[model samples]
Target: DQQVKQNSPSLSVQEGRISILNCDYTNSMFDYFLWYKKYPAEGPTFLISISSIKDKNEDGRFTVFLNKSAKHLSLHIVPSQPGDSAVYFCAASGLGGGSEKLVFGKGTKLTVNP
Candidate 1:
């Protein structure tokens, strides 16, 4: 069973527009949620993150929203640019026993068309 799920495998958007990627989780123990962007032949880099204590976190053109009760989270990109096109991953982690590991979703490929 996947603890984190990204139902949409892909998304396409026009340049200078907005892109929204959704994610769901089955684990209630998840206290931290993060979004990572990966380009082909490269590692996923940290994008934005939100703690369970906060419902939203934003940085630059990226924003992350978390809904604890629904076990859901979403990432929003404003003014999407071609450079923003990449595989977006949703990850969750919880602190326990002085250790924590992240559980990530498969990923959603975003295409930004010029």
Candidate 2:
């Protein structure tokens, strides 16, 4: 079974509008969550992360929210710009028994239309 899932395959938003991406996971053992943005032919670059203890984390225009009880998470970009258009992936890792591995969602493609 897939532990991580991105329900939406794509999203389109107008420039200067808010862009929201959603993700869900089935693994309750996951303690750390991360969001990464990737461009074509390039590796994913880490964007934001949140520990299980924290409900939200923000940096500049990007924010990540975690709902541990629901096993869900979301990423929000306010006043999204053209450059923000890219494929975004949500990743989760658990620190159990001193072993940790990252499980990632397929990804959601965000399109910012000017």
Return the number of clashes found in candidate 1.
0
- Per-residue CA lDDT of model 2 for 65-88, tens digit only, reads 999889999999998999999999
Whole-model lDDT, model 2: 0.93
- Candidate 1 vs. true structure, TM-score: 0.95
Model 1, span 27-105: residue lDDT tens? 9988888999999999999898888899999999998999999999999999899999999999999773213789999
What's the CA error at residue 18 for candidate 1, in Å?
Answer: 0.8
Model 2 residue pairs with clashes: none
TM per candidate comes to: 0.95, 0.95
Where does candidate 1 stray beyond 4 Å? Answer: 96-99
TM-score of 2: 0.95
lDDT of 1: 0.93
